[model samples]
Target: MLFIQRFVEFAHAFPEAPAIVDASSELSYGELYKQAQRLVEVIESTSSGSMIGVLMEKSVDYITSVLAIHLSGRTVVSLDRNYPVERLRQMVTSIDLSLCLLNEQEYDELNVMLDQGIRSLRIDKPTAPSADNDSVEIKPETLEEIPAYVVFTSGTTGQPKPVMVPYRSLSTLIDWMLKAPGRAGTTLLYAAQGFDVSFQEIYSALCYGDRLLVITDEQKKDMHELTREMVSAAVTRLFLPTSMLIPFVTFNLHDSQVLDDLQEVICAGEQLKINPVVRQWFKAHPQCQLINHYGPAETHVVMEHRLSSEPEDWPDLPPIGKITQASTAFLLDDHLQPVLQGNIGQLYIAGRSLALGYYGMSAQTAEKFVTHPQTYERMYNTGDICVLNEQALFEYKGRRDRQYKIRGYRVELKEIEIVVADSELVEDCLVVARQFGRTTTLVLYFTAQDRDQDLSMRLHTHLTTRLPDYMLPSFYKKISAIPLTPNGKVDLQKLPEVGGLRSLISTSYVEPHGELETTVCELAACCFGLDRLGANDNFMDVGANSITLISLLAELRYVLAYDFRQTDLFEYPTPRLLCATYQRSLDTTQQGAPTVVPASSRKQRLIAIQRFQEKKGG
Candidate 1:
């Protein structure tokens, strides 16, 4: 059944049951249904095209708008509320966006940012409650082919490709999700609104009669607050991207019982690496299951591997597991023929779970989604390279294209290179994605026309206008010329190491004064790949992101033996400010009772202090 149809049934069966809960409010199934019905009436009367854009911030109302559009037989094109206005404009213009659904706040904030004369409607709950409980149902056969929504992914051609997903695709994935073990109880909706995973979190919960807890962006950033919210809400199922999962477990799950109700955790969006921290986390919470899911935007979730065994036995790189029952996956070579069982091959998926194809890019779509020669079934050629293991399960090797997942968002390096090359600031450029301390970051190496000292800063400012934050390179390197091989292709191996380059920030270096400042600076330098860092160097300017900040927090707690909060890093991003904040915390703790540093931490501090003194002597 379609998730919308199932949601309607759930509402009628349990009207008073809680459906959505956020920080400020809770909406029962009955209230949610009533609001959606009212919104549906408004949507149907708007005379908009088939594609309806949802531009509201992540909230219950935003979800209501999505459901209303589906009920009105329109496709939802979610405009990420946090996306830059320039990027948002590209999405709106690319599709036949006839109407945008927004709340009062977004309507005011984004009115001028969006295209002029674009029609929009404000989402407000009706003063009079709706008495109708009528359900909008489409026949199964027809619904399978109808477009439900469009998800925008990075395109190799310097634009975001809209993947048109039909109702059957999502229904197939959600059906498998509901039947999955330990997926019951309250599920946290932590994914960004624009991503397809949010659909899984929403439909899998409400459609299956599980409570959906919507965490705010602020809470999602702060590890301490996120943990408190999870414990308080008793979230049983968590869907975290692999990038966030690493630091979350490393820093937050030390207390085995912090999230006593967490029974299942699913990680996707990036390759899962079972590091030591993750192993220790699972060892502490033996009852919680860790699942690794793998798929592209073209197919929601084609394969998943669940680990319920002891953490000690888990592989460092777990297999993506057998294909889900909803879809069939094949390992094919360059000839599109099935590869031998043990050989690495590209994965091709074909089944009810396949999407309709890319919107407005038929050629690109045909290139990706092709018909099998013998079977004649439509299959999506996933650029993922994989090999079958001893158990005949698919093990992810790497990507065949220049695409990379940064903080769970798929980015095509070619797209960024095209933008940078067009900036007129550089004669030629190449962008590469690299894994730095468990975090994936983009690094751009370019040869500029003028080679001015401020070219890196100028290029950085130019890219921000055209690309989103995730697509921007974390570090910029000014090379004399682009490295090329005999075939005239960019040679990635020739690029210099980003760590050995001069500081990207132009701030003058200031040596640390005291022991606390020196220790903090050393840890900060270690977190970011810098040999030496000034006290005033901004973390943001040095490629410090939320993931790195979490890693730094874990390092700080371990080395300082102080319970450093996530908010402290945000409030004081620089090394000097952070050290000052730490000193204040220490002073407060000392006035009442001295907080003893651990013996191990004392030894580490002694080492850091000794290193600082030696540098001074030199």
Candidate 2:
């Protein structure tokens, strides 16, 4: 009722307030509510209780469509824009959708086969009404069915797994959020419509008829542009991943000025690798709240909230946070027995917010969503490895399996390695995550015979560009050989942990020149928290390249205001020389000379990385 009532509350109270905003458009709560109502009218004409597939880029249109589907009594099934067309087809059939909602672009792209008799509502300019009268009051299909959404998880499996979220649980969550009692004002950042975490912004803002700052999908990925919005907007609450949240720390860590208006910083997705960001916020303003939320997609929203001021007692309530008031966490051993505190175990979450189950896979759903033998309540098995403390708060360890988080982005390591295997430069590759000094960074080791690539920079840059910024491996290492076990699988544990970066980047890179270059070189060296940085020293061995590295780069780029790629550092290995080369490149491009973009350089460097990968077992 609370989630359903949220729309009505916002419509009555803040009709004129902006509910969503993208680059060139703004939709007020009133308009959004109206559109949803119209959509409801359209849905009653179709099969009742059918799932409405919401597919499109993140926008006010996409957001409004989802609420409309929910209001229409139809469950919403979100289709991710990032995935391929073939994947959409496979997932659609798996869910057995009755109706699919589409904007023109998505309709053509997906090209859903007409054989299944799936109904679609084409969003076009409205014409005169049909004989089906407007007086007909339509009841919502979900009134009996109860499902509000079906979300797909991005995991190691090639096929996307659908998780059903019901209205009762959603209502429970939205009600609790509205009652969470905060200051008079709260603002939300609308990052993406499909991702469940985006709700922290939407419902949080809708709670008090507060403003929702909707960044377009393009702007969300484009941090340079996003920075402008962050400083300029009159914002208070920011919900972001640790990697995305790192920028604020580097820029504001030393500054005494509190975000002035910024109040609560809710971090979810991946664990917080860097502390300085939240530490600085709390230091600047004692009242500022920094909440680290950890839970799986099954939990409707985050069931934990950990707030700290000045990081008291260090590592106490570190890593991740505790369960929320309405939620319960479990630390289950290998046999599913409850584990003691500090002993690593698989985390299971149980609460009103627990999702219904996997949409189609009943067996898989039964395996994960199990009834706790002791409490007799349903609990979801989270594949994450962590421990439950005495206070009941959960701390994250790593994954139970090979899946890992990089810069707060959930990554299937083998997926990235697959891309490497397909690329020409990689002969053999193994990826491992190394946790040192509270931060877990990724290290890649591979071997090759006749290498022709600058393996480190190419792989780093290639992965960085293709995936979300957080998924980029912080440290890239190419090795002459990878350790193998008797079974011939790469023996990850036996590999050298300290000697990776130099081989990746220092192969043939030269340093840059001049004051800007020199200062950058010095700043990078200092920022690394390194004892010493030499021309040939690799960042892998010295604990370099991370979300922190991206943050540092952003600051430097803002000052430089000149566009540069992370790969640029590969070409100019040393600080001094890299800077000098960057300056020269800028000058050359400015004066009408064709930019001497290095294609061969990227190709060759990738070859070196591939070469090293091939030697993994040889």
Candidate 3:
């Protein structure tokens, strides 16, 4: 009810103000409220429970459906439109969902997955109501008991577990956002709907009567397009996951003035480390405030640290500043006792911001949510290892569980193992994260008598259907058997190094032939720190970080005299693929005009030798 009450207030205060904007449409506060009213009537007539499923993309309709469900005193479960059919079915069956609100496009596929008794309504194809209806009347006390939304996160059992968040918790975040600096103006809702950070973008903008700009999945994947959309929309407030933010700030928007109007940029979802590239960006853009937000899905953004001025000294990782007024965090050891200051301990969160616990998993709920020994308050053990610095700020160490972040996505090693073990070619599987410089690659070690090449292809094909791209292991190694410790457990420390395994990229070598191909290949080899590079080798596998990629792109831009997007590196990872793409672009440009080489013969020789090093005889 608090969510609805705030919407009603916003509608009354700024009825004509734009509330949500997507590529195709825009909805003002008044229009949004009217749509929600109609949707609430439909939901009340069809659903009897408090939880409803919302299956739609990031658009105005999705925002309308969420508000309608909240106004109807029901919790909204956001079902991602991009989820595989099997994954979607699992989520639908996991909860006691009786009604699902979907758009016309997704209704058909999702309809087949729902039970016969469960109802599915397409918001886009809504039936006309007999008459205009008033808003649902709910007391403030009743609103306190209803959950605002439910989000699912990776579980240890290789399945996603749901965490129900109450309305008050959401309201607390909105209230804080309203008072926070640079709260006004358009905020970009760039995160996927399934992520809790997306909720911050949605509710904070609507509650404060600020414009909320939405980007499609395609735009989110292409940093160039997303930057164009942000600039075109005059976006001021931005929220991005650390993974995306790194590339955007370091490469895509490196020298662009498109985001000069940005007032506040919040980075969350993964750990925020103050690397050289990130520090350089902060120094370049001092007008905007850079905030590092830290919290789990259970407690949405309970801690915030801001970097306003250029940093004189760099730290390994940014501090997760003071806790919010709505929550309290403790550093406890394995025995649940408070650890001494500066010592690493498991983080425990307590207070109103805590979630309602895992849905339908009472045993897991009891194990994770425990009563504080001293305060007699309910607390959720965050399995993250942390320590309190001398400045009294919480500093993140690492996770205690087998879960880690891949491109800002929370991935459980067991989850990958579960999927891999389902393959017929795999006898047993052990997945681990391997770090080389700044890049982290997931490596899968398995027992298979077949050749490594055969098993790798087979496992990759099989897992592609079951898992998302980020969750896929980058390296696959076939071992006779998993190394076991004296205690008969898998010896993770003794697992084969990633370098010893076959590179996931194509192994067959392809030599560059044409002058253009040769030039591009030489530049790529320089960026990767290799003497002789093959066309089939991947830039990432050869030690190309974000910084190196940016430098490579800059060199290519000057030599080719053609603008290139940062996303090109991801789409065409190998030198062979990139050379082909560049040739195609050149062909298109030269179709109507005479061909002219951008670089002179001597200039090309100098560019090729920029980073080339001569090999010495051993």
List the global CA lDDT of all models: 0.81, 0.61, 0.75
Candidate 3, run of 10 with poorest lDDT: 609-618
**TM-score ranking from best candidate downward:** 1, 3, 2
Q: What are the root-mean-square deviations of the candidates from the true structure over C-alphas?
A: 4.3, 8.5, 5.1
Top lDDT: which candidate number? 1
What C-alpha lDDT does candidate 1 achieve relative to the native structure? Answer: 0.81
Residue range 350-369, candidate 3, lDDT tens digits: 98888888889999899989
Off by over 4 Å in 1: 125-133, 179-184, 500-522, 530-537, 558-567, 592-618
Candidate 2: residue 393 Cα off by (Å): 3.0
What tens-digit string does per-residue lDDT give for candidate 1 at 224-281? 7888889998998999998777668866644778887898899999888775567878
Clashing pairs in 3: none
C-alpha lDDT (0 to 100) for residue 607 of candidate 1: 66
On TM-score, the leading prediction is: 1
lDDT for each residue of candidate 2 in 117-144, tens digit (9 for 90 to 100): 6777665447336453322233434453
Candidate 1: 10-residue stretch with minimal lDDT: 609-618
TM-score of each: 0.92, 0.74, 0.87
TM-score of 1: 0.92
